[model samples]
Target: MKRYQFNEITTMQYIFLISGTQIGIGILSLPAQLADIANTDGWIAIVIGWIISIIASTIIIKTMEKHQQDTIFDLSRRYFGRTFGTFIHIAFVAYALLASITVVFTAIHITQVWILPNTPNYLIMMLFMLPGFFITKNGVRILGRYAEVVFYLTLWMPILIAVPLQKGTILHMLPMLKEGWAPIIQAVKTTVLSFLGFELAFVFYPFLKEKKHAVKAMVIANSISALTFLLITITCFIFFSPDETPLLIWPTLSLLKTIEFPFIERFEVIFLSFYLFVMSTTGIPYIFTTVFGISQLIGKKDHTIVLLVAVCIFIFTSFLYNPSFFHVQTLGSWWEKYGLWGAYFFPIGLFIYTSIARWFQRGKKK
Candidate 1:
């Protein structure tokens, strides 16, 4: 048996890794989704969602800190019984797999719509998955560094396309909360799905070189991600009417399509090139988590086989839905909701259980 040692990644690199993973094609459709729920007041839901996400992320960080070097899987097994812990671990892996498939499906759908209309969906899916598998197989440290480099493309490209188009009316956002608090609260629930990847911090926590600073890094990464999503959501709502936003499949890209730079003929083309980089970063972590989860399950430390298995599963699942855009979107939405539950709710429950168990053990020791 070959043992592969895990390298510790820098706090800054981890920050970018977390941010890059969290911001994906989801950012593209979030305004439209929120609009569907809260109308023009959708941005309010985004703000509220961020507040909740921050609280959730803080709990995750604190829980990891209390356990120091233990992975969430180990902590779960220790806090809950082995049976319950194994169940939660399986749920985590399932959520990661579903999320990865959704990312691949969405990437293919976007490429088919915007860039490669003639390319077979499977071929495009292969192109995206292969590189991510190779990188993640190298290890999480490599993945974090690669994500750091890719983060620049992901962060700047959307802004480059969006910042120039600040020409729309802020009034479009007005008649605030017309549907009242009910819809705004529901929209906040929907918007929570967009903040899905913060919990990845739990999986990656053991690899941090500077464990003392991990919580700070996680906070910074999630804060930046929230601000970026908020800007994109607000920009889309301001530039396009609520009616126009939901009609278009990818509102962020649609907003870019309307921009014509002096030197650049089509801004959407520039946006697409950078968007691919973002997709790669976003998709790689899901692949890493899937591989990591399976490796832990089978007691294998060699990640190469795990990576290959993950790629095969992702490619196989991508084909399962017959490449229908609506089918992919619906499946993605369902998985996104499930991901929020697993990533946020399940882990928090484990944390509460762990705290109670520790308290009981202390009392018994006394």
Candidate 2:
């Protein structure tokens, strides 16, 4: 029963962690997804989505604050007692596992589609999952460092995306929200999936070095994600006709293909290579959070075994299933529905319950 040291991360690292996690494979198709629903005004949905994400993130922070230095597992136990709390904890672990699966599989699927069309899916999943386990096993500090590094390394992506706008038609974005509020609301629903990673804040909240700054970090992180989504979505809208936009999957990557350089051929190939770093930032954090949550629930001080178990399960499942493009999209759509519950609805529900419970306890004390 050896206890490992808990690694703490700075507020800034926390911000990068949340931002990097949220901006994953979903961003590749976000513009097209929104366009299908909201037309050119999809960026408006991003704004609305950001606001919703920020509010949800703040609630998560406040919830964690109520149980200082305790992970969600500990808080659940305190609120629900050991038996039911462990059940709740296990449920969250399951949710985190589903999230990690969605991320790694999506990344592997994208790699196969864009880079190595002939590469075996298992190989791609292993390549992504193995390195992630190595990083994740070290705990949150290492993860925070990896996220910060990925952010600096890929900062050039947005600028590269902007290059395509030179050929874009500004008029394409005109007649704003022609379809009005309904479509934008629908687009916001889709955008909520894109903002999925912030909810990981619950697991990582106790690891923040400056816990008081947790809300601020979450707000900044969600804002960065929102701004990034807004930029890429607007860039795509102005560049492609509304009808043309929804037809192209991975609209962001397609935009990269439009950029040509004298020395470089197939610019997207290079972009996708570096983008693996970005994708790992999303997957590894979820993997760590899931494994760590299970460790806490099971009273394990050493999480390495749990990590290995989780990775092995991921590999086994990914190896067994070879999803087609349409199947993968459908799978992701289903996960997004689940994500809304685990990320947004769960936190809000927990917060309200905790408040009512706390009020009852105070009345009893008086």
Candidate 3:
């Protein structure tokens, strides 16, 4: 039950962890969701979404910088007062818990569909949650390092899928913006979900070794995530007809299945194994953050105890919404709207409050 010091993780590690967490299962469905809105101009939507994400992320980083020693919970209490801030913390914890549940269930659904049609869904949930719980049980620094390692698989899988450009038709993206700007802007809202994990920077800032470089890490993480997602969106749009893209549940996996390697008959089987690692990299941190925040709330500094509570919560919630696989998809779409609200708006509001409070304090000093 040792308490760890802040400033243990380097800026690069923070950037990589944030980018890795953001890029998870969202990438699989983004092309279809964006296409549903923007049609063939989904990539434009992704770009616009990235612009909004950048602005939001910048505000979050600046707010964290203003209160270098304090967590977001502390800042909220300072600005919003004790009662309101406690409510805000409860809201944050709820959002984090729901996000963890959504990801676990989504992973279970994906596994049931693509990998193990006959495997019991609960078993699949346990398989994914076990490693994540184990890692987070160690500490945040351990979790950050593990995320960096698994992130390589995240990069490699997409590159391997992208190698089949010969099968992709650049013409598929043609008649660009034929539907006009409104659809693209609408699509951007959906695509932006892929970049949601960058807000973790606010929570992780105190763990950064170079505090001044936190903002740089945040920007780099978002930029890399945006670029990776943009590539996926454009490549998928070009590779498959917009009509065909929506037909596939996991379009990225579908893309891998289409790829034929000289020695490999099924690229997807290999891809899924590595992709599971990437998915864990994305999911484990959300659970970790939730646990961390809860521990902070209850004044518990023991990582193992906090992690056990998180594991129990994940296990409990993972089953609470155990409808069939189709129901899981429906739940995901519904949960996504809340995801957007929690991940995007909550931090932005906090940033605004912190900024105004800082200005007032400075005015009083002057």
Top candidate when judged by TM-score against the true structure? 2
Candidate 3 lDDT over 1-366, as tens digits, reads: 112374277777888888888888898888877877777788887778788888878778888887676666676787888899888777777767667767777877787777788987667777887888788887778888887887764667667867766788998888988888988877777877778887777677777777788767778888888888888778888888988887776787777888886887877877887788877877887887788788878887775787886677666766665667677677677657777887788788777777788899999999
List all candidate RMSDs to the true structure: 2.6, 2.0, 2.4
For this target, which candidate reaches the highest lDDT against the unseen true structure?
2
lDDT of 1 by residue, 294-354 (tens): 7887788787887887678767865664468777878787887797787678768867876
Pairs of residues clashing in candidate 3:
none
Q: What is the lDDT of candidate 3?
A: 0.78
**What lDDT does candidate 3 reach at residue 117?**
82
Q: Where does candidate 3 have its weakest 10-residue lDDT segment?
A: 1-10
For model 1 the local lDDT of residue 214 reads 76
